[model samples]
Target: MEELTLTTPALLFSAISLIMLAYTNRFLAYAAIIRNLSDKYLKHQDASVLRQIKNLRLRIQLTRYMQIAGISSLLFCVLTMFLIYIHYPIVAVWAFGLGLVLLILSLLFLIWEIQISAKSLQHHLGDIENHFKK
Candidate 1:
């Protein structure tokens, strides 16, 4: 295999930083939505709103997992760079590989969350349709 230099891990820095930024933004959006939902639930306690809250709760948890995996990926990449700096090329390669795996896991979580989000939207749409039908 080719040499695992510091530059190899350094290359991931920009990509990981952007991903972390996106994940943070997602978390912030969820927080805002949760707060809004909480207020609505407090005021009315409607079954529909409660269902939405439950959906949001699951989405928020998945978002947290995504953030954790993404952060761990960044941490591993940093570790890889450190290992390279200390002249452990083999170990650096392994660390970098682990980082990649974590990143992939994060993306998988994101996909799952998105699927759930779409389903939730569809449920809302179904409610609207039922109201119109009535």
Candidate 2:
């Protein structure tokens, strides 16, 4: 097998790190938005707000899971990159592939969570509309 270069692993690690950071930031922003909405509109003891809060809580939990996965993947990528540089090309390749899989899984979970949140919001809006009709 040809000797592995550090550049390939280094670039992969950098990309994974950036992706993880972006995912973490997205989770934080989502949590902030939910909190702000609850504080502003749910103060009147509205049931819909309560439902929304519950949905947000679930979404946050999923986001947390994804964030954890993303971070772990990034860490593995870095470690593998170092191994590759040290002449363990086969091991490094396996590690890099595993890291990539983890990152992809995290992204899939994030997408699912967002879809759930959107569905919950749509349901809440529908309920509000029905309230107005009566």
Candidate 3:
């Protein structure tokens, strides 16, 4: 196999940074929506509102996993670079591969979270649908 260069791992730094930024933004947005829903639930104690809270809780948990995976990818990528610097090419390759796998896992979680998010919005849309039906 070819030698692992420091630049190869460094290339991932920007991509991971951007992904982390996006994940953080998603978490912040979800937090705001959850707070609003919780306040509404407290005031009225509606079943639908409660359901939304449950969904949000799941989404929040998924986001946490997504964040952890993304961070793990970055950690491994950094380790890959460190190994390369220490002149360990074979191990560096393994670390780099693990980092890529972690990145793929993070993406999968994001996709699942987004699917759940779309379904969550459907609850709100159901009201509009009911109105039109009547």
Candidate 4:
């Protein structure tokens, strides 16, 4: 295995920062959608709207997990840098490895959320098609 260096962990700083930015954007979008959905559900009290609200709730939970994992990844990266600074090369390597694992987990959660979102959109489209057919 290669020696762990401060630069190695520093490299992830920008990548992680960008990922966090993307995650924040997703979260904000979800919030807006939730508010709009809530208003619609209150006005109509439709079963379809209720279903959408439930789906959004699940997606929001997943997004929260993604953000947690991403933030943990960034924390580990910082820890790795600190360990390297303190001359703990072995622990630094482990810290860096853990950070990478957390990043991978975050990406996996993102994929799951995207799949759910796509399925929800497809269902909405199907509803529109059915209405037109009737």
Best by TM-score: 4
**Shift of residue 92 alpha carbon in model 1, Å:** 0.6
lDDT of 1 at 22: 88
Answer with 3 or 4, whichever has the higher TM-score: 4
Model 1 scores a C-alpha lDDT of 0.90
lDDT of 4: 0.93
TM-score-based ranking, best first? 4, 1, 3, 2
lDDT of 3 by residue, 1-134 (tens): 66779999899999999999999999999899988988898899899888888888999999999999999999999999999888889999999999999999999999999999998788679988998999
In candidate 4, position 26 carries an lDDT of 91
- Give candidate 3's root-mean-square deviation (CA, Å): 1.2
Candidate 2, pairs of clashing residues = none
TM-score of 1: 0.95
lDDT winner, 2 or 3: 3
lDDT of 1 at 52: 88
Q: Rank the candidates by lDDT, best first.
A: 4, 3, 1, 2
Judge candidate 3 against the unseen true structure and give its global Cα lDDT, from 0 to 1: 0.92
Off by over 4 Å in 1: none
Candidate 3 TM-score, C-alpha based: 0.94
lDDT of 2 at 71: 80
